[model samples]
Target: IPFSSTTKYQISIHAMEEGYCLLAMKGAPERILARCSTICTESGTQEMNDEMMEICDRACTELAEKGERVLGFADLVLDNQYTKEYPFCAEPPNFPRKNLRFVGFMSLIDPPRPQVPDAVERCRSAGIRVVMVTGDHPVTAKAIAREVGIISYEEVIEAFNINTIETLPPNLPFAKNKAIVIHGAALRDMNDQELDRILYNFREIVFARTSPTQKLHIVEGCQRLGEIVAVTGDGVNDAPALKKADIGIAMGISGSEVSQQSADMILLDDNFASIITGVEEGRRIFDNLKKSIAYTLASNVPEILPFLAFVLLNIPLPLGVMAILCIDLLTDMLPAISLAYERAESDIMLRPPRNPRKDKLVTRKLYFLAYGHIGLIEAMGGFFVYFAIMAEHGFMPMQLFGLRERWDSESVNDLLDHYGQEWTYQNRKELEYTCYTAFMISVVVTQWLDLVVCKTRSNSIFKQGMGNMVLNISLVVETVVACMLSYLPNMSYLKFYPILFRWWCYSLPFALLIFAFDEFRKWRIRKYPQGWYRKETYY
Candidate 1:
């Protein structure tokens, strides 16, 4: 017979000169021992009495407690008279399976991989509960779980009273510090509510002698408690749970095709340590993505505020439409993409798993930091440069207000400046382009500081290191591109114009201010970790 979760054993028959002989029955020790009616003693087969059964059970328990997987073996010899009545064929007639002679026990030790203990410790430190579910006996499972550090020796001692609860109660006397080991037979009898209660009560759990169906139930029970579960398996019997879990990791080397197909991810090396590496990479990517988003969004205010000023305050547009396109597509692209290459600011595995519901990629605090804080300062920088350039050319900030209609009019050949200087349309148009260049320069400069400060949310730039070569190269490229857009000939069609070197110098203070302000914010957050400043402003 083939091995199954239900049968828990396999049998084979052989042809002998005397008759057909069933060579072996190998499976769960208890299941195989239960089917035997006679025991093979030193002299001959003897009736299996309660005393013999107790001795066999005790031996199996001892082996299992020693962290060995135990299997029982039994066989029977049939005479010619029995085979003659039920002749052997491709499909042999059913023969009596009872009264078989019980064989001695066999045990094998399979130690866990060396790195598994450290990986399990990392999971625990990360606040991820590691549960072991296996078809092994309860004692064997508990022993291995302890060896792997899933449950400590002290927890096992505390939970020894109810180590194997045959029946679950409405209210378990489970303490928060205690760990529990449950038998699969008891799990089979548990309803959904009782299973949920069991899962809720135990932070560390071990499920022994579990069937495929029981594994699926455990996955469902965790999901019902709003926990995100990731299950790993390598056998066909594991496919159901693998499919049901939020994330299913399949072992490529030993895993069945069915399990791999059902899994969300595959571990090619089949090492458990790879899973911790993946978690660290995932957290780093999430942090980098947030940094990229914040960097990208902060420039939106500087771009939009110029147009807003043109419409509401009736001032000449500080930034042109083409300039906004250049900022988004050219100067900002490389820096944002380079954030993905940034190394982790800290040991990401030391932090608890982020709450999916409460902690998001983009929060209100992120928006406030991007638009209201950093972006607001960037917009101010752009406007300061715009007005300074305009004032130098005889158009005062106050005089530029409510001048949009006349400023853009094609028919107005001459316009009066604050100094009463007359300017034709072409002259004023060149001045507008200069102002556009000035504002774009201010945005680009301030964002350089923005990118540096955004690299680490809680760590200072000096501590985080300015060592992302990709980002450093991107900043150099941004400066080159900005210069090209400003100084390149025939670029006026894009509303870009060459500005004096002093205009570049004017935006430097604002850029430094951005760096200084963000550094101060990070310092405050680090100094007073539990303060309201961190709660409200530390995005």
Candidate 2:
């Protein structure tokens, strides 16, 4: 190529400015003056003899065969102004471009991340298949993949590669080995059906020399096989594939803006281990959401049953409407919110992902748990407080039933109690307000245990610990709020009265009962996951 025709230019040593012309430096001595340039491999190679070339070729082959990256070395003799303005013009005088010297070659290896092997093993243990796709040469790709545990260090008999000539293989491998390495050239001509077939069969794979479109096709093919694909990339060319994936992960430090914008997740540390941490964290969040929802819903049964009984049995309402509002908006609210901060159960990542079609936030088992089991028990606790207070003061449990009309009356002043005390309408009305306060306190107390139970769905409370300081702080706040709402002076608008502290203490055992019962249920569920009892009772 002519000097002007050459779009790019490079330095040369042991050669003149006029293309290897035999011109010596000024004031020549035995030692060459290398003031303006440096001695490097490109120069070293040209001066090297045929024997040296054969040695370098062998060294490079050995290094490359071991999957090490090689960099060629050559000698570059320094020169003055001539190097800066070296003439590439048609051989000035009698010079020709030839002969230089070479130094040696270097083999470098970029070691894999320290945590990568462990993370890859964890993914394997979780039954998650990981595939590596890169623009590197096949040897380098295979080496890195093996280091990261994506592929075992074995060459399978039915391996696929760039060597395949047909657009589709004459007969696809049956995938007994499960590990296959494919080049971008092999995938470039593959139709979607062929892509799907290969991906659907192989559990472990590597794609080398892939273009951006080939990567996008791989992601789409995975989705076609109902796989939840997570594509990770850092380049602008990777944006399309990242967007096409089910979940896209972008490296925050190394990623291009287009890829980061297209991705659903960002790895701030640009480490493969961070993705595993993210997966664990994501599973915890989902489990915590379910717990928060279940705890929030458990309080509803106790809240609604009071009104149901009042309307049916004609008793003065055990819990007032405003009190229900207080339980939902005040005492119960923070505990439910605190559940979001709870840590995961022990086996959060050990189990497979719950099927989207089968597992739900509100399942049949959850409904039975909230409204039938725990809720039924809590509702009984509330009524127990109500009846116990009414009976002790004057009225009997049976007499209070069917008494809503006379108890709430403006005219009636004489209601006979089982203790033979004749109570006026005003006195009876005050007692009814006290009952509402007791019911509210009952819910508050039981819900504290509910919070603890909800900390873990299946794991024992002892096993998970009351995780997250927020839960403890919220429970404390719940207790104080319940006390203030029940006994604050002149707070008639809230329909709460200063009830006896004895009624508050009376409800403690029921809360303990709830905690013990839930712990037992958890044990049963864990011990017998496939048993009919667990299937029927687990939420």
Candidate 3:
């Protein structure tokens, strides 16, 4: 949800009720949102209406019952005393995508370098349009645009004469298409109302001589268009816009502490390049989160399959408590940790910025791939282990090897002893304990192999790369420590690891099978036109 108001005097309460449970005040909107339940409220020059107060009462009641929190205004108040004794600040909205416009005060900095052209080109190629908003004179803004390589004469030659241009001239021709430059003269006589009217026509607009209030107007106007606007500012005059934007971005080095406080993201280096880098990092983080979800949901499949098969068939249960422990802790977690380091794919940025309306978990195809194909491979590997034992040792293998029934049922133990083994119920318990140990060991090795498999698709494991070396080393070291810890008898606490050297040899063929599957997948993807990694694609 997004909103903007021109006046600080009064705002509709409906806007304030749009999902914020807690309201922290450093601005009029926040103050209004915070004081929704009060009979009357005032912050800065703004005041609340009776209708607003009524809405606030209902909202407060709803929030209080749910134990939802709202804080960071003048006084700290907990929503529900009984359910939530502890006070907590409101959590920031978790938007799937963020859209920000950087209004460069043209004369305030160095000329746009050659890199600016390439950057602009890259942005447009990535479907991010650029607009140059400046307080400078029209001629100066045009000159800068030309030198920056964003404007060509063909885009200008047939247009009105430069001498004829005046303050508050009608909207220019290329406003809907290529990059635009808004100069002081083009809208100097225009008040907030007229400026907003002009700005509404262009999806993105740049302006010069924009005041703090004007900046706020720009932010509000963008919000009206349903954009997830982020405002970047350094001057004291920029505070209103900084506070008004959906997410405020501030310069850490040269910007005032007030600007920094008002912002959600701070640019430590205070370079335009840093903003691009931040965007890339944000995209990667979002992508990795999707990967993590995929990893977790897929690992659950193999853990549940054998038990389901056991119950449906009259056959005895195959997975013991120790085995379940092994699968859950050792087999499942390590590979997931390794997956966290998967490099951002080449198309991550090439794809258009995700729609702001989308959910945080944006990549559904990848998740399905993880859960469907990858989980099937893992289940097959486990089934192969079960079958290998059954074929070699006969029916005794089924009685002794199944980890689930061994740990959970005593009847299963009696059945195992009935198979002509010298073991009593006590000895069967001890062997069950050993089965857990072996399971844990297998789980750990299998998880490591899973990590190794995920790291390479068509490529050999040795030829594969961890794009981020520092992160890769950290994950590898952590996995090694976890693998060692999974082997401890009691420390393995769940008795999940049962390392059998002979059985371990089977892992090589299972891994090779995954390799073949990956190679086939890669080939099919490359053969299709819409495939993300099809021929001539950029990395």
Candidate 4:
């Protein structure tokens, strides 16, 4: 018979000259010690009494307190008359187990990895609670949990004075700061409501001598309290709890096939520290996704306003279709992709996990900032450069208004300008393309500052620095591509024309304005974290 939590022991029969001898029966120290009626002494096998049993129990506890796992061994010999009637080989369970001679106890120690203490400390500082669950004796489990910093030694002393949880006062509130250790025997008597109180109260819990069913009950109780549970296991007995947890982690090297199949993720190294690294990486990816989305959406206002003006105000088109395509597909693609490589901010792990119901990737505040604030400013800057280029060519802003019909007509060869200058149809068409190129340049320039601002949500750009090599290279490439499209010769098929150097300089002030405004917004959010500005404008 194999050892199980229910039986707590394993039995085997061996042939002897007189009869079959049940030799080397090993199991849990307490269970095996219970059936012993005699002890093996140097003189002979002596009858075991209550005083001798207490002494043996104290020895076993002392070994367990030193972080050693203890197992007891015993043996019993069956006489030929009894063995012939029972058939010991076929009926192992029916074999005589009581009145066995107690041999001794065997203790083994498996120390935790050195990196576990530091990882547990990190989890504590990040507002994550750490729990220890094991099938070892309570003293051995508490010793290991204390060594790994799950609970302090003083807490163990204070909380475990009572033998069982039923001895505690019923009306006494469970303390959140105190740590508690519960035995599986006590858990078997607890109902769902009692289990919930334990899960909700203790920040650090050690469950010792637990069966597989008790582990599953703990996971279910936590889930009912709206907590996110992550369970780690390496045995077939752990498969049920691992499958029920929100994030199930299995050991790659030591984990059984049943546990691995039930787990959501497998740790190749079987180290607890790797889970911390996985958490930091997951948080970094989420932050970068938000940055990329914000950067892409902010340019929409500037791109759409030109066509709106062409329709509502009846002015010449300030930007062309081909130029808009270049902005979306060429100049903007790499910089947005580069945001994914941005380093995590300093406080990524310091904050508590986000609420999936209330906190979202895309919020109303994000849409307002992208469209109503930063996008509106970029649209104004593009329009300023467009009107500046047109006015320098003897076409003022007011004269350009309502000129869409004559501007596109092939029959109108001579178009009168604000200064009474007669312009040929071909000359006016070239000026329109120049305005298109200038507006596109303005959008590109303002986006340079937008990309920097989007790198962090709460930190200043100076603190974050421009340390990302990929984003810096992307910015340089974006500038080079925009300038090449503007100044390259024979590029009229793309509606790109060379513009004056001063037209590119016109958008610099607006780009600086964006940086200043975003810095001020970040400052306000940090100065008063609980203020209305953080709630309404922080995103």
Candidate 5:
């Protein structure tokens, strides 16, 4: 059966009725057997022979022994067959108060996971607070909450006496003004009074005597104060509240089918530890998305640098529209996709949650790093290309030259002829070498710089030993491929100037120089305080 607890009860009952021989049952084993056998009936079976009677006797003895050892609860089914025989009693037995040592009873009567406490504490460290809400009595709730490290053992588990909210303990110190133990009756009747007080004035609060409706109300009230609520539920009654939360977390293992359907995410193990896993996943997703935005903006700026320079210097655009499309689609796509899979930085969860209102383009310090460093690298590369040509001409080169350095009178016309040929037709294949080389140098070096910038804030900037071996290897491979690509032959039609195959080899040092400059910038930003690099305007 999907509900193992219910299945165990049914199985145990059948075992008891069949007179199955008992071996050893204690603790969880005993509880499980008892719960399973609760529905079993030995009433109309054959008359108890010696062996049968002995089996029954053993079962009875075991039940009594274990009953005193654990908190046992059973559903009392009344025999409606008999009438009340006109007997009336004036007073009922008064259950003792001190005997109520149960701090909290979980509504989830399912067996507890042994690791809930450790998992909860880890979440607390990640800046996500946990507060337990259950229909169980205050004593039982408190016990579990303490065991799970959600609350301390010294605090009293506050409970309202029945439906009356006013019956709560008077002159309560408010336990840091958070009412760590706010009963469900109070939560439902107070119209967000305790909730608003807690959200505004308290650090944390634990709720008890909560029904599904009350749970939903609490979630809504918390959201009103701008708190993002992740509600976890696994039962039929929990479906409505789970649907209402900002992030609905459902238990996949023990959760009801309805609850799982309503939830945004289902925890595979039904362990509280899985909740922590989900939060980590959310953080990683957000981080990778931020990286994508940073990478796209940085990448686009560099690709467009030659064009921007052409506009500024009143020169013809070195790259045509098709060339821009080719580079954007081919050269830039792979590395940007690679950035999406960048491994989580060591401090991903160590920091607090990013504000939802924070803009990926504007608010974060990473954006500044992306624009400042990336723009500088692009401009430097373009300047070198322009300077290399100018130096070759002695002043300015108006005449176009082939790979063999022979002059062509119609320089622009010859360049257009080269652009319209087979080399251009298969630009992805031919320029695969050059474009990829440039892109490789640009991205890998920039990302490494990005790593430095990210780590410096955590005082990790000084830790040069922390390097990603895989990223390092990928960068080496990219550099070697780019270097070898420059020497590919048969390039006369591709350019008016001599194909500086050796320039590909030369670009490597510049790439490394870019990396060093980025690191220097990070250091300068920290060491120089008010002055480092010039702030460039960006969207």
Candidate 6:
């Protein structure tokens, strides 16, 4: 019936053994009740003494320091037979089963995969913390943590070994600034209040000799102090804390069914770098979303002002409905879409993590900067083009006032200019189309200038450079598309015609004016951090 005649097993598993059993119950300080064995040795059944106990302890420490999971074994003395209490693996139904000899320990090391260190560094740059919890010797846990950048590799190894500390500091637990390694037994002794203090203050921490319940305790303690927690696990034991974390990340390839069921997300490759990539991508998307909104709003003030002025002042319509549609739906769309391809700000990782309570997507500063300042400027520039064109073409700005009613009359084609020149319906329509083309060119050309300014909230666009390929290509595409909308003949839907070469020359100064003005505004904001302009307009 027996495969090995000399085998006699004594085992107790689950939380009580996996978490609490120490030294294989051989040298542990528990009461003894039975003495039995199936194997006999020549050296008087393998004696348990001080030297043998030392060897077991040394074996555990060595394995742990090398990041190994050490298992314990014990020899049972054969003097009396005992009834089996636990099934599968049995032990005598009594405390500290009698006459146990300390058999040496064995270990397993699951070497960490490559790229984990770089991923951890990225998390640190983004202001995320990493903590290690393991049911292994403190030395072993500390060793692995150090290898992974969780603990500094340059840290003196001697400083981490607590027992070797011939002189203890006043704050015994936190003497080392680089890292603090806690033993599981010592952690079990600490109350939640003490745990919270350590977690709140320490920059680096390693929790060793932890049980399944201790890991749960660590997650709960961090949460109680208002920290967002994310737990990673692959075993059934990790299920409880995985479910408790704000974001539970499970290893897909190696994870158990229960862990997969509990996790908020799973990593198919099981590489920690994926998490860092996610953080980077998420931040990039949020910044681009804000950029697109700001860019879209910046032009709306100018587009809508033409109608408002016509309704109130009754001036001849400077911009018709078709012209507005060409600018809004056709010419301006590409550049606004291009804003979505902007790269992350240069200091995106260097800045402190944004405060969730204070930072926001839209704010008074954004509104004032986008609508009240840039938008107003664009509106004024558009109107100036209309005024300049009319003034030079034999009509003063004053003469165009209150002309909306007559300008719209189908039969009124002999409208006279300041030079006493009568114009037929066909001739006046050509002049009107010329003005419309000038207005369209003004908005399109000016918006390209605005796009450069919109690239950064504060920094110089030249300093950031134009390496974003999507945005660079979109710039080329927008230029071509806008040219077609304004210059190509027979654009009946847009009521547009080819703008004169002279109008292009006229627009150069206005576009330059917008760019120089924004540059000056940026300079003042940078030079005077507390200035009112920077405070209200630093979008």
Distance from true location, Cα of 6 in model 2, Å:
22
Relative to the true structure, candidate 1 reaches a TM of 0.91
Candidate order by TM-score, decreasing, is: 1, 4, 2, 6, 5, 3
Total clashing residue pairs per candidate?
A: 0, 22, 24, 0, 17, 1
lDDT of 4 by residue, 168-212 (tens): 544425453567788778777888988787777677889887899
- Error in Å for residue 462 of model 4: 2.9
Query: Comparing 2 and 5 by lDDT, which wins?
Result: 2
Q: What's model 3's lDDT at 273?
A: 60
lDDT by residue (tens digit), candidate 6, 1-539: 11110122334422232233321332111111123222123565555555655555676677777877565555542222222332323332343454555444557677787899888887788888898886545777788888888987354323333343323343634545646787666666677877776677666788865667888999999999877788988877788889999889899999999999999999898988887777777777777777777777877888788789889988766776787777778777877888788888775554445555555777677777778876777777678877787777777788888877777677987878888887666765666766777776677777777777777766677776887777777667767876787767677456777766677556656667667777788778768878987777764
Q: Model 4 Cα displacement at 242 (Å)?
A: 1.5
Report the CA-based lDDT of candidate 1 relative to the real structure. 0.87
Model with the higher lDDT, candidate 1 or 6: 1
> Higher lDDT: candidate 4 or 6?
4
Give TM per candidate: 0.91, 0.77, 0.59, 0.90, 0.63, 0.76
lDDT string, candidate 1, 1-539, tens digits: 66888779887767667665655678999888888999999988899999999999999999998889998989877655555345554334365555678979999999889999999999988888898989999889888898899887466522222334434344556446677788877788777987788788777788888899999999999999999999999999899999999999999999999999999999999999899889989999999999999999999999999998999999988899899999999999999999999999874677779889977999888998899889999999999999999999899999998999998898888799988888888998899999999899999999999999999988889989988999999999999999999999999988899999999888889889889999998889889988866888766
lDDT of 5 at 318: 40
Kindly report which residue stretches of model 3 are placed more than 4 angstroms away from their true locations once superposed: 1-110, 113-122, 149-177, 183-205, 209-213, 253-261, 326-335, 338-348, 362-367, 396-446, 452-464, 467-499, 516-539
Task: Give the per-residue lDDT digits (tens) of candidate 2, residues 1-539.
Answer: 32120111223335555543332221101011112122235433233445545565566557755667654433333345435346544345323322323434556787777999999987877667898887654555777787788987375322344345244344446565546778666777677877787787667788876768778888888988887889999987688899999899999998989999999999999998888888888888888888888888888999989899999999889998888989999998898899888877778767766666678867998888888888888898999999999989878889888998988888888778897888898888788888999999999999989889888878898989865899999999999998898777877777788877889877788899899999999898889888865787676
Best candidate (score: TM-score):
1
Off by over 4 Å in 1: 41-51, 84-93, 157-173, 410-414, 523-539
lDDT for 405 in candidate 1 is: 92
lDDT of 2: 0.75
Worst 10 residues of 2 by lDDT: 27-36
Candidate 3's displacement at residue 466, Å, is 3.6
Candidate 5, backbone clash total: 17
